[model samples]
Target chain A: MPNQDEIFTWVHTAVEAGANVAFALSGLLAGIRKQLDVVGICVVMGLAAFGGGTLRDVLLDRRPFFWVDHPGWLWVLIGTAVAAIYLLRTTHYEFTERAIQWPDALGLGLFTASGTQLALAAGTPALPAVLMGVISATFGGILRDVVCNEIPTALRDRRPYAVCAFVGGWVYVFAVRFEVPPATGFLLAAGSATGLRAAAL
Target chain B: MPNQDEIFTWVHTAVEAGANVAFALSGLLAGIRKQLDVVGICVVMGLAAFGGGTLRDVLLDRRPFFWVDHPGWLWVLIGTAVAAIYLLRTTHYEFTERAIQWPDALGLGLFTASGTQLALAAGTPALPAVLMGVISATFGGILRDVVCNEIPTALRDRRPYAVCAFVGGWVYVFAVRFEVPPATGFLLAAGSATGLRAAAL
Candidate 1:
């Protein structure tokens, strides 16, 4: 049987990967709406997928960026973007846009939890670490929309997007502070954020 | 008498300080245009002034941050913002906006050159180093506008802003490659970018 640490690592990686895919899908949809070329779409996808994590790493002074550490994820992103472009061509924009919300909420939870955990591990103070989680969970979409010349939905949308991340980050921090079991604490944090976002939607 | 390296450090610090003020001033103008409150104005000012260098430092894994290293500069920024707010309230909007161009252009040059030089110092490759210069020169203003919900002037302006930075970065790179004296090379790069941007304006 795998150790708790091993299981946490696997689950963490998978969740982040799924979250990345959700963000990349949103980028693809944005690119398609903007009528961007293939290169533009890829660029947007990369920014949308990695911007938050990159910002978090920078804030924490971490090395080997998330995308750099997982080079295969780049290929995965490209494949997802290409496949998505084809699949969504016939889909209604309204439905496609709404469909992205589910995974985006998942992304909100997992990214917030992971980003907070990373910050705590790095020995950052609580409030700033929680801010890091929010930044990690939201900055990618902000970058995408800003690049596309639209107001960032994270900032402008009425729904409680960043609030979910904020709550999730605090949950993780409190869990760690209280010595909750690591994996369970992580899951609880993520679940709260995802559930909150889903409820808001 | 100070050594050559000592002179370089002094000159670099002064130029960067001046550039930071210029960016903060632009941020003030932006905040006033958007009618932000006092705290909002200060937040925008900080983001506009430090966003680029912070981004570059993060990319290069360099620390302590420029503002952090010079804690006095934070006071300077607040003072400048407050004083400018009082001074500009009586001035014509058109005049204040145009007056900002001179310093903004100067910032573009110095920031581009310094960012590239820093990248080179970090052992980054040539092309990537030049790109870093462009990012350093441009990204702050981009963040400022994005936060303000306006399209980034860096992206939309027909003027030759980033192009000047690109050229300036190459000038610095080539100067270093060919064994030019450091101070002269730095000035040459800055002058080229400033002149180019001024001409475009």
Candidate 2:
């Protein structure tokens, strides 16, 4: 198990990787849909990265949030967007189709688990915790879709994306209540969510 | 001069126009910046149209904001966006530049007034009222800029847009306190905000 600093670093890396993948996928969708230019692609990608977290922070009345304080997220997003365009030019749709599902699931899992943990730490009740889990996991995609002028995949007649988040949140809650180590509980919850999402996809 | 219903009709017309113009401009900007696609443009426009009110409603804890209830605004934004593409294509940069200042000021005025009124009606303090006024007038544009990967124009070292909103809100409060007719007072406040913004521009 990692120390606190190591854990934070790992989480940040995972989140950044997740964000980059999601943004790249969103940009792909935007490009295919003819809803964006290169700049628009980057914009959509950035929204896919930060939109959920921003909304969650604003709603929870949290100050500064991660993006506001650590402005490096902006550069990360910009770099990822540029990389995505270059990668997309050479890569085929089949490549993305095969490549995206795992990381997307991982993103869903990690974001949901973190969201649930944050809400519980902030003293929100269980229901709100689960809701935040889903929100944190899915809202960036939702915002991306909305900006792309498409229905949110979570809100549409899609597979069980939010359900995975909801279930994972409950798992974390139970794990904490049973006095499991925080790291173990978070990892278990995130793993469960990712597994569920991957299976659905 | 008009009855309440008539006033609402005018208000509705102006709101529809303002909302469309705001979205259309944002879309155009996104296109020029080469940052968005068709869906991306539409999203930018829709968010630009509805984001301000949604933010205000969410902050004030008002449920089922007007956009969520009235889907007509969505259609309005769509129409405006489509119309704007061609209109913008034909229009010269200088003409577009000249056209934007007044509408922006008008939107600021109307949105600030409505936001202030809603906050007061919701029983928030006076300070929050002014904040909401600025939020309602400018946050949509801010969100648009942020998503488009640009610094929010409102936060830039430019004209005192939010300043007009803050001062205009106070002007509204004084007018109401002085028992001025609501319509007259509203017009006066909105007019003052517009004038201030125009002068600053």
Best by lDDT: 1
In Å, residue B201's CA in model 1 sits off its true spot by: 16
lDDT agreement with native, every candidate = 0.84, 0.73
TM-score of each candidate structure, all chains considered together: 0.61, 0.54
Which digits, one per residue and each the tens of the lDDT, describe model 1 over residues A1-201? 999798889978887778898998889889888999878899899889899999888788889997897899999888877876676677654547788788888998998998999888887767667767888998898789878877567754657888788889989999998999978888999999999999998
The best candidate by TM-score is 1
Q: Please estimate how well model 2 matches the true structure, expressed as its whole-model Cα lDDT.
A: 0.73
Clashing pairs in 1: none
Candidate 1 lDDT tens digits, B37-154: 5544655687799889888988888876676556577678767777766777776545476877888899999999889989999999999999999999999998898787888899
Model 1, stretches more than 4 Å misplaced? A1-7, A89-94, B1-46, B66-139, B146-201
Top DockQ prediction, candidate number: 1
Writing each residue's lDDT as its tens digit, candidate 2 over A1-201 gives: 778979766876766577556645764665446435554555566567767776877778775555545556656665765676677678763444456667778888888888898889999998898789889888888877766656666798578988999999999999999999988898889889988988887
Q: Which regions of candidate 2 deviate over 4 angstroms?
A: A1-12, A86-95, B1-201
